[model samples]
Target chain A: MTKTTGVGRPRASGAAASKREARLAVLDAAGELFTGAGYAATTTRAIAERAGLRQASLYYHFPSKEDILAALLEDTVRPSLDVAGGLSAKLAPVGARLWALAYADIHLLGSARHNLGALYLLPEISSPRLARFRAERAELKRVYGSLVAAAGVPGELLGIRTDLVFGLVESIAIVRRDQPDLDVEAHAVEGADSVLRLAGLGEPDAGLRDSARALLED
Target chain B: MTKTTGVGRPRASGAAASKREARLAVLDAAGELFTGAGYAATTTRAIAERAGLRQASLYYHFPSKEDILAALLEDTVRPSLDVAGGLSAKLAPVGARLWALAYADIHLLGSARHNLGALYLLPEISSPRLARFRAERAELKRVYGSLVAAAGVPGELLGIRTDLVFGLVESIAIVRRDQPDLDVEAHAVEGADSVLRLAGLGEPDAGLRDSARALLED
Candidate 1:
C-alpha cells in the first residue's frame, strides 16, 4: 500500500493553484502592512503592491480593505477563542480552567502577536469596523468571564481578576513588541501564574513559587 | 491686626499684575488643550491664541513646551505620590499600606480625572518625556514594591501585586476617559478596593471593600 499526502493536489492544476497562492499572499502582505502602518494609513493598492500582484487581482480576492481586515481578525481571533472554549469545557475545577486559559492565551499571543497592534490601534482609527470587532471581543470576554465567575468568585472580584489577567497579558505583548531582547514567553507564563495565585485560583505551590522567583530574577 | 491686603504689590503695578494674570490664563488654556488634543497635537501657539496672549509672552512663564508638560505632570502626579508616600510611611501593617495606596490612588483619580487622557496617551506618543516621567515613577514603584516585598510575600508575587495595583488604577482611568457619563470616582474607588482584596488585603473587617462598594452603590 502507498502512503498518500493529506489533502492531495487540487484538480485545477496551475492556474487555480496560482490563484489560491496569490490570494493567500495578498492576505499575508495586508496583515503585515496593516499591523505596521495601521489600517487607516494602509491602502489596498499598497497591499497589492507588497504582495507582488496587480491591484485588480487583490480586489479579486478581497472586495475592500475592511474585508481583508475582517478576514485577518477572524483568522487570528477565532482559533484562540476556539481553543479557549474547548479548554474551558474540558477543565474541571477553577484552577485547572484558569491554567488552561492562561496556556491558551500564551499560545494565542505567540501566533497573533503581530496582528495585536492592528487589533487594538485599528479600532480607534476606524469606528464601524471597530464596533463589529468590539462586539465579537465582548462575547469572548463574556465567555471567559462566566468561566471565572463560576469558580465561586464574586461578580466584582471577577471583573478585577479579568482585567488583571488581560492587562498582564497585554503588557507582556507590549513588552515583547517594544523590546524583543526580553524573554517574553517566560514572562508571560510567570505573569499568568502570578495572577492566578493572586486571584486565589490556587495556592502558590513551592515549585510554582520558585519558578516565579526565577523568572523575576531573569 | 491689619490684613495687609496687597501690601506686597509690585512697584510695576498694573502691567505686572496683568502679565501675571495673563501667564496663569495661558497655563490654564494650555492645560485644556493638552487634555483635549494630547501633548504632540496641541501647539504652544494654539494655547497662546486661546488665552488671547502673544506666543512670545507664553514663553515668559514657560520656557518651552516641555516646561508646560512638566508643569502639568507635576501638578497632576505629585499630590498622589505625596499621599502614597505619606501613607506608606504611616501605615503599620503591609496590607494597610497597600490599602492606603489604593485609597490615595482613587482619590487622586477623582480629583485629577480630566488629566488622565493626557497622562495615558502622552507616554505612547512622546517616549523621551515618558522615559523621564517613568524614571520618577519607577522610584515610586520601587518604594511600593519594597513595601509589598517586605510583607513576607515572595518577590514574584510582590511584582504581580505591584503591577496589578497600578494596572487597576490605569484601567479605571482608561474606562473613565472612555465613558465620561459613568460615575468615575465611584469606579476608581471600587476598582482600587477590588484590587486590594485580590492582593490578600481583604480580610477580617472588609472595611476598604465596604467603603468602596458604598461609593459605587451610591
Candidate 2:
C-alpha cells in the first residue's frame, strides 16, 4: 500500500508520468524552501514558483504546505525504519546490527539535499498533520532502544542510553546543516561508533565493522 | 559587555526597573510562542498579547521578532559556554571536566521552560541577526572539540569524534522536547557518561562522577 503510485487516479501513461514528475518537483521545491526559508515563511506560491508549477498545480499534488512537510519528514525516516525492521530478522550480533542501522541512518541524513531531519525541531511539526511522521520516528526510537537493550548495556539507566543513541544519530542532520563541507562517510562511522559506545558495546572493531557492512549490503 | 543590562536606556529608577521587567516579559512570551507555534508563524502582535503588553510596548523591548529569537537562542547557549569556560581552568581529570560540562549543558536544556535550544534548527536562525549566537555556539563546539582531543581519543578521526560528542550533548534538547516527563538529573548523568564514552573514556567511575559534581558545585 505504501508503495502504490496512484490507486485512484486513472490517467493515461503519459499523463501519469507527468503527474509523478510534477509531484516530485513540488516535493523538491518544498524541501528547499521549507528547510531554507523556514516552513511557515515558505508560501505555496513560492514553492510553486520554485518548482516551476502553477500554485493550483502544486496543490493538486500536495493538499497543503503541511502535507509537503509531512512528505519530506517521512522521506527522512522511512528508509531508516526499513533498515531497522530488516535488521531485526537478521542473525548478526546486536552491536553489529545497531551499527548498520546508525550508519545507514546517518548516511541518509547527510545525503539529503536539504537537512530535513533538522525540521524535526520545528514547532509546527507537533501539529496533528505530522502525527504519522512522529509515530514513525517513535517507532524507530523504540527499535534503537530494543537493540541497545539486546546489546546488554548494564545499567539502571538503560532508557537514557537508548535515548542518547537515537539522539546522537539524529544529530548528524544538525552537523550537516552547520558544516556543509563535512565528510559524510567519515562522520557516519563516528556516529555509529558513538551509538555503540553509548550502548556500552564500546568501539566498533574491524570484525564488527565488516559484519555491519555485510548486514547493510544484505 | 554581554552582561550590561542597559547602558544607554537611562530613565528614572522606577521606569528603568519596569522597562527591565517588560524586556523580560517580551523574552518569556517569545520563548513560549517561538518554541510552541514556531518562529515564522509567531508575530509581534501575538507575543504582545501573550505578554499582556501593547504591540508598541513589545517593539520598545524588542525591535523585531528576530531579535527576540536571537535573545532566546543566546539564553540557551550562554550558561553552557560559561560552564565550559570555567571547567577549562580547573585542575582535574579531562574525563571529569568533560562530564561536568555535559551535565551542566544537559541540565540547562532540560530546565528551560520551553525547548529554546530546539529553535536552533529553525531556518530563520541563519540570518545575520543570529551571527553572535552562531559564533558563540561555534566557540562552544570548539571547546568540546578541544576537550575531547585532550581526553586523548585515538585514531585519525578525532574531528569526527569531537563533532559526535558535541552533537550528542546538544541532542539532549531534542530528547527533552520529545519526552517531556523525563528525569532531568538522571539523564544528565547519562548524557555526561555518553560523552566520556564517545571520547573513549569508558563509563565514568564513581570518582569521576564525584569530581564532576564538585566541579559543577564550584
Candidate 3:
C-alpha cells in the first residue's frame, strides 16, 4: 500500500482538482523520501523529481520544505489527535477508553494507504518548524499517561508505562518498514490488548471491549 | 551518566593507552553529534572537532564515520549480545532469563553515559557499512522472540509481541532523549518488568527476581 490517497488518478494542471491531486502527489513523494533519508538530506528537487514535477513547480504549492512536512504531520497525526476529544478519556472505564484510543491510533497509523507513521521517526521533528506538531503529539502522550494512571499504574511508574505502551503502538511504524504486508486491523487489536496488559488490566473483558468499540465507532 | 566509560578522564594522542583513550573520546563525540544532528548530516570534521582532535588525527582512531558508528554499537550493544551466549537462555525459566537479558540490555542502554541508544535511531543504520552490527542486534532480537514464545505468546502473535517487547526495551533509548535526569538502574528494573507483563508475566515473585538477579550477576 503506497499512498492510495491519489496515487493513480489522472488530473489536469489548470483546475481545482489539479491542485488537490498535485498536493497529494507531492506528499506521497515526500513521505517516501523523508523516511528513506533524514529530513535534512532530502531535497525539494528530489521530492519534485519523485513526484514527476519540476523543482520550480514545488514552491507553487508549498512555501518551503517545512510547509510540506507540516502538511504531512497534519494529515497523519490529526487522526490520533481526533480520537479522544478535549481530554475526554477520563470519563470512561480506563481500559476500555484506552482501548478505543489505542485502536483508533493504530488503525490510522497502520493504514495501507500510506506509511505516514515513519514521519514520527524523522529527527527533524525536533526542529522549531514542527513545534506545533510536537505539542499535539505531547498532548496525545498525556492522554495515554492519564489512562495508564487511571488503570492503576503508580504515579512513579506512569511515565515509563506510558512510554512503553506508546512505543508498542508506534513500533508499528518501524515494523512497517520491513514488513509492508502487515495486517493493520489485527495489529490494532493486539496493540490495544497489550497496552491494557501493561496497565495491569490484562485482557479487556468482552463487555469492556464492546463498549470501547462502540464508543470509538460512534 | 554521560558515558561512564571515561567522561571525566583526560587524554593525549600518543601512547597505546592514550590511543585507547582517544578512541573512546571519538566515540563519545560521535555519539553526541550523531544523535544530535543525525548521522548523515554529521561530518567527520565536526566529530573530530568535538573530540578535540585534528582532522588528520581522527583516522588514527577510526578510518571512517561508519567505523566510528560501528565502534559505538560495539561499545554499547555488545553488553546485550554477550548476555545470551549461543542460545544459553534456554537453561533457565524463559521469563526469568528474559528478565536478566532485558535488565542487562536496559542497564547498558539507559546508562547516564552518552546516549548510544540513539545510535539505534540513526536512519543510516541500514547501510551496508553496518551489516555486522545489524546482524548482532538481530540475534539479540531472535533471543527476545524465542523468550516471548517460550513465555506463552501464541505463534501468530509471536512476531508482534517480540516487536512490542523489543520496542519496550529499546524505548529506553528514546525516553532518555527528553528526560536527561533518568535513573538508569531503576528504569532497567521497570523496563524488565514491563517486558514480562507484555509476555503476560506481571511482576515476578520476590524469589524469582532475586534468583534472576543472582543469575545475571554471574
Best by the DockQ measure: 2
Task: Give lDDT tens digits, candidate 3, residues A1-218.
Answer: 24345446675644767676677889888877876676778999999999888877788999799888988887766777778783374467778889998988888878836666665645566778888887887888888998899999999889877888887777777667656798888888878888898889976677987888887765
Tens-place lDDT digits, model 3, residues B29-57: 88888777777889999998988888888
Colliding pairs, model 1:
none
Better of 1 and 2 by lDDT: 2
Question: Which prediction has more favorable TM-score, 1 or 3?
Answer: 3
Candidates ranked by DockQ: 2, 3, 1
Give me the TM-scores of chain B across the candidates: 0.73, 0.91, 0.86
Candidate 1: where is the Cα deviation over 4 Å?
Answer: A1-77, A110-126, A155-169, A173-180, A194-218, B1-76, B106-111, B115-126, B156-161, B194-204, B207-218
For model 2, how does the per-residue alpha-carbon lDDT over B9-61 read when each residue is reduced to its tens digit?
66679677778778887888888888888788888999999887899998887
Fraction of native A-B contacts kept, per candidate: 0.06, 0.91, 0.46
**DockQ of candidate model 1:** 0.14
Better of 2 and 3 by DockQ: 2
DockQ: which is higher, 1 or 2?
Answer: 2
All DockQ scores:
0.14, 0.79, 0.51
Isolated chain A: TM-score per model? 0.75, 0.92, 0.84
Model 2, which residues run further than 4 Å from truth?
A: A1-12, B1-12
